[model samples]
Target: MKPNVLLIMVDQMRADCLSILDHPVVDTPNLDQLARDGVLFENAYSATPSCVPARASVLTGMSQASTGRVGYQDKVPWNYEHTLAGEFTNADYHTQAIGKMHVYPTRNLTGFHNVVLHDGYMHYSRFKHNTKTIESQEYTDDYLNWLRGKTGQADLIDLGLDCNSSTVTRPWHLAEELHPTNWVTTESIDFLRRRDPTKPFFLNMSYVRPHPPFDPPQVFYDMYKDLELPDPSFGGWAETEDTSGEGMSPVTAKGLVPKMRLKRAQAAYYALITHIDHQIGRFLNAMQEFGVYHNTVILFASDHGELLGDHNLFRKSLPYEGSAKVPFILADPGNNLGLKENSRVDKAVEMRDIMPTLLDAADIGIPDTVDGKSVMPLCKDGEDMPWREYIHGEHAFGEKSFHYITDGKEKYIWFSQNGEEQFFDLENDPQEMTNLLKVVDYQERIEKRRNQLVKELEGREEGYSDGKSLIAGRTPKPTLRFVFE
Candidate 1:
């Protein structure tokens, strides 16, 4: 009787925009029917791609140099011990967390039993930058105090837009039920109709609009306004060009925006990813109208990935697989675990294996200061497990601080601050557009992933690896510049 977990998350989403990851135009028919009912890790990742250190390595399953958060700092002090909804709210499960919780005293219930926040538009929770004000939206955010009690309004500045802009692309001006992705799916279908039906629930809807004021609601921006979309992934070790008009700024992260404003900002970022995939198909038909949809397990992920402009980059810290890959899926709904429906695990996983694979699929236990492991024997069938051939990833965002390591079929990176070194072969250029690190037939596979990134950055201190090499120009720090005793 343990199942029910749900966890949806999504902010700056990308992992090739799922249409089962073919994503040529982003339709996501209910996340491709939750990837045909389960298990599609196709090399997931988010080893610190952004959003507060990829949600602090997804609520502490660890890694990101053991949760000290290797970059993108904000307030710090999540003081973790164990989490993933505090170990399924310590096995009794009834946790909550609706919409975004970018952590830190914006009411830190890092172990949610309730978290109806709406961390959208956070410029460090601006109410004049912190200590919140503007009189009141109930002191800052419960989706802007329920959109000022359904728009009798007071603020949320009538969508002039700037929730971390990508410069511009519009549509949603108002009423899509005051869109914060439909107020996080109507507060997660009103917490599955006022939850607590004898425990067994974990919730956490999370979503902060494809991540940006990419706005999506003029009927999902005219349903991809005159389709044709596709052109961005360019890379011969990308530098970018063609800034046609030279006025870009909806939050410009690099350059070349102006192929009709980068196809109307990629058609308003695929109309805010099909309006958050039809508001996650109305929060999965309200979890099958409260029966918790066939026992439940679901999971879908995304704390990172959204280079929307690819190598010309734009948003996300960028080691670039469209900004550090992401889009795991899990789904169980009582297939009785052993995953399999629409299978595809291709190894490499990350974001610290999502809290020991949802606390080892609810029997719950995984804690030895978790460093992530439980992929439930790679979702069953033959079950050999023993994975992790590679996963390391990094961020720091200064001169776009870097570091990487892959194993989802080759990738090495580096770039601390111009010590540059790239080498991709993501199974024959998965749009990483070739840079076999000076290709002398891939110098012994770039000296074995640069000696596994010098044994994963040996004893860093801006030294950036010396167990055998890679010392780049250094000086990058937003955090994790070194403090581990």
Candidate 2:
């Protein structure tokens, strides 16, 4: 029988947060257990590190350029023909998504048979900005509506939290049962109870915690609040960052804040992760109770990594490791398919590979248009497959707009706005604190990677590449959709 596929996604979770990854503070026991049971991709990344574009790549098995979402723009129409859920649905799987789809129209479904969405306080979908008014937050989001019903409050103001701001750390205003993380897990467990059992199922439990407000349940908050947490990392090249602005949230600005303030935020962030980890444990129990634990293929990943004050950067969208790399683990049912147990694959991989990997595992044909190659063969101990030498990634963020390439061993970055270049040897400088672009000994490899990036963006209008060398000082659009000439 084809395995029931459970694709679990978390938002803005760092790749290094797992105990299995030797994270000193945070503990994700559930995820660690999953890693021990399956293959973990040590170098998984998000090509575009914001929510929408990264999700677009995950859904369509396409590159950011191919998905036409090269930046973090809301309300762009999602018109992809062969989404991951759509393909599974076509193959007769019962497809359902619970929690944060983050797709446009808020209820697009994107080929899922049904979606219970909670996109988490999007400013664009709020009342005043919503022209139709019918698609406003209260009416559009199933979670918010449920939250309102649970609280018995007509209107709630983000539960005293900011979606984009990482400055504040607080306990959840509502009960833990009503929290969005628990809601997503509860809904998914209920899905197992209600799904058509004869046919295999495809369920996406997309959690939206650990992304913002740095809010978790108070118990979780207390769990890490008193620990001797390490201070935020500061890169040597980050001395000139702006650290003095009133409205500067973590995502919008780069700078160091008070040590206590940063530590509190990190505590809450880890607390949120542990909260979700516990909820995942609950989810697994429900799966076992429903008699589906032994016949499911469980895959877990995050949309992107939070900067968490790394290099004086807070939110994602930068090309730094803290913003781009994410945890990706696939746990097969007791290595039933000859997959390696408790093994790690260090080859470069990204969100695009998810669609093909899941489809291949279910014995389905991957669409020919997908740019991602399946990594399933790599999971089998002796199976050999052609693999990518490096994965290309980029995003548009005004002056921060950048492009780069990395093969897990080295990375090359080019700022499209100012033509500034940065190179890092991951083997030596995993922290990416020291820039190696000016080192004469590394110039040859630097130019090689630069040429590779040029080849990737050669024909673009941004004048990024001029065949022989890369150019700079070109203004970048916030959103770059594919255009047909």
Candidate 3:
């Protein structure tokens, strides 16, 4: 029988939060053990760092450009013919997804054998006047329906927390078992029990937490409330005197917040992560009890990272490491693929690589539709294996819309609305405290990176480049025109 595959994913989890990676405050013993037993990729990034577009790349094995989802947008139909789950089903694997499949037309399934979904709080789906009746959570989300059935409450908002708020912090108001994170683990373990024994299974266990609401169960919240957490890092370029009172808003993307509130939010966010870690431990133990522990191929990653007040920015979709980078671990505990154990790779990989990697591990054929190459070679052959030099990332954030290219050691940024440029030597300053754009010594290197960006955007509908240089003032769209084609 082919090896079973398990893809563990979390929403808005920072790449640097693992204790193995020396994250100062957060304790994730389960994740740390997962890393120890797997090959960890230190430079994995989301090419388009947001919930919707990032998930598109993960599901389809397509680059952001190929997916035509270069930015965050909701309500767009997921019209792809191939998906990670669909491909597994094609090979006769029993594929089931539990928790957070943020696709549109919420029940689309995207080719899963079955999906137990909880996309968390989406404004578009919850609106009273939503034109598409099928889009509402009441009509689709399995977790919400379960919560409503278990408790009399209609929604998570009963706790008085906004899903996307950055400044708000609170403990979950319900029983610990009812939290969405625990529900995902519980449903996943249940699937293991109920799965078909004759066929290899593909299980996607996705958790929606550490994203916002900043609410963890009370025990988790107490874990880091008074631990003297690290303050948020601010870049010199991002500091401002305006203090326009915008930061006071609960969900403002860019603004200075009170130090106490920010620390509390960080504590809550860490609490949620630790809570997820514990839940992951629970599921892993269940896997052992069910006798699938030895013959499984497990890959762990996140859709994207939260800025968590880095550079005074909250949420995702920015080119900064805190928002775009994510933790990636591929563990073949059975040595099914002869992979190097307890290793680390610094290659610049992205979410798009996931489908091909998992498919390759299962000895399944990678379809021609996949833009991402299987990263299995990197694990087997180490740095001697050939790989892409850098990854290009972009997001459509109005005036803040930007394009970036990085090779893990350095990054180059170009604003599409204006011709402004910024560069950071990530090797020397991982926090991106200083911009090196105007530095006399780094001018030649900066020019080379700029030319690379110009080459990357050479031919496109957006008219962002004219071959020789980047064109300014071009409007960026969340979805490229080819999406409709």
Candidate 4:
């Protein structure tokens, strides 16, 4: 059963930010509808909670610890082995990657034959001389260049201020009509119009809006202003005393002052998500337009979630649900596995399972070597997966390092260097407002999980899920039943 694959990944987006998640301040009707007609995973988790590494884990079907890509600035070292796209290609599927993969070089395209990256005009922050794309001028070329060419916009190139050192004086709408979604959507649609259908394609596309700069053009930016943004996780601020890393604060903790205007930042973030949701509408429409709607599988998700001031953090890299819980939507047009729309799965799912799941969905063999289990059963109801009781993740950004494991009821976090420990009984405190690392009684549970973590890490290595046994191929093919209504 040959079918097409369209995987949509958004950067730094939170699972709870959507209206479907009962987030009152934002409107993402497009995503809302998509979730309705798709299986929503309520507890999908990141393999590791950083951008580059998290994305790499999803693509490679391995843990970030094994890939050695613990840094945001680190390249997805080719040594990790075959990526999902590469696997599909090897299996004779035509693969493409458009939008933001956030792979190093920003637009490396990695293995996908067709690559289009619409960046946030991300420059080489750590490296000065490298051009992100093969085409040097393209980074700031399209609409950004056109906007810069405009009279009023031209004078405000840098806003004559340092974005890192900016203050929250007023609600500032990021200036520009050419938002990342606009450009990304245009490129995606163009790719769709020219796509060849006979080959059965696999497009690993991504959207770069909700990632950073918390900037959106006018209409979108205004869409959420004064929308009664949710109260700031309630001094989600002071709770960071237990976390490790830099100041990681937005207040006057340093000479930088406060970087985000809480209200304004929320408004901008909501707007960016809305804009992204609209683009999703466009892609969904494209599926129907191309007559591939019933023969393709659509996956929409984020690599990891952003904190957005939860615990006073801006991005992912923390273990709180705000940072680790990512969107997991699997919409099978054929409902091959009998997955129903708007159905929510309560089981704990790690991102590592995505590779094997996709392989299984496509009738390929599941690799036993991969540490993640396939969830196609729970997705369609074959066998119970025994849902993971504890999900583990780590953050190795720069010199900062931390490890965490959570089982929905309890969470344990530890920093290696100074050996700081933090624990929370999430069932009692979902907000994780309290720390119990050094608490008694919980010691046994913490030690058990720590031992489990060590065993899991020690088993890590290179290769596909079931590489050797793939001599016979393991991705399972399910009995399918398609329904139009």
The top-ranked prediction according to lDDT is: 3
Summarize candidate 4's per-residue lDDT along 1-485 as a digit string, tens digits. 47787788888788888788888777788777767766778778885776667777777777655455543544323544567787788777878776666565555655677676554444443233774445454453344454455534542224332222112222224434355566666666667778766688888767776766555667777787757777546332244342343443332121211334666767777787888888788777877887877877777888888666665555566667777888888878666556766777867777787887787777776554466666777777623556667777776543335667776567776554345667777777777777765678778987776665555444233211232211111121110011001
Predicted structure with the largest TM-score when compared to the true one:
3
Encode model 1's per-residue lDDT on 231-296: one tens digit a residue: 887877677554453437667787766678778878887788888888899888878877788888
Candidate 2 local lDDT, 280-379, one digit each (tens): 9999889889988878899999999988878767889999998999999999854676789899998889999999999999999999879887888888
Root mean square deviation (Cα) for candidate 3: 1.0
lDDT for each candidate structure: 0.79, 0.86, 0.91, 0.64
Q: For model 1, what is the C-alpha lDDT against the true structure? A: 0.79
Ranking of all candidate structures by their lDDT, best first: 3, 2, 1, 4
lDDT of 3 by residue, 133-226 (tens): 7677788888999999999765878878888887789899889999999999999999998999999999999999888888799999998999
lDDT for 269 (candidate 1): 78
- Misplaced by over 4 Å in model 2 are 127-130, 154-158, 240-243, 246-252, 382-385, 481-485
Best first by TM-score, ranked: 3, 2, 4, 1
Please give each candidate's TM-score. 0.35, 0.96, 0.98, 0.80
* lDDT accuracy of residue 371 in candidate 3: 90
RMSD (CA, Å), candidate 1 to true, equals 20.3
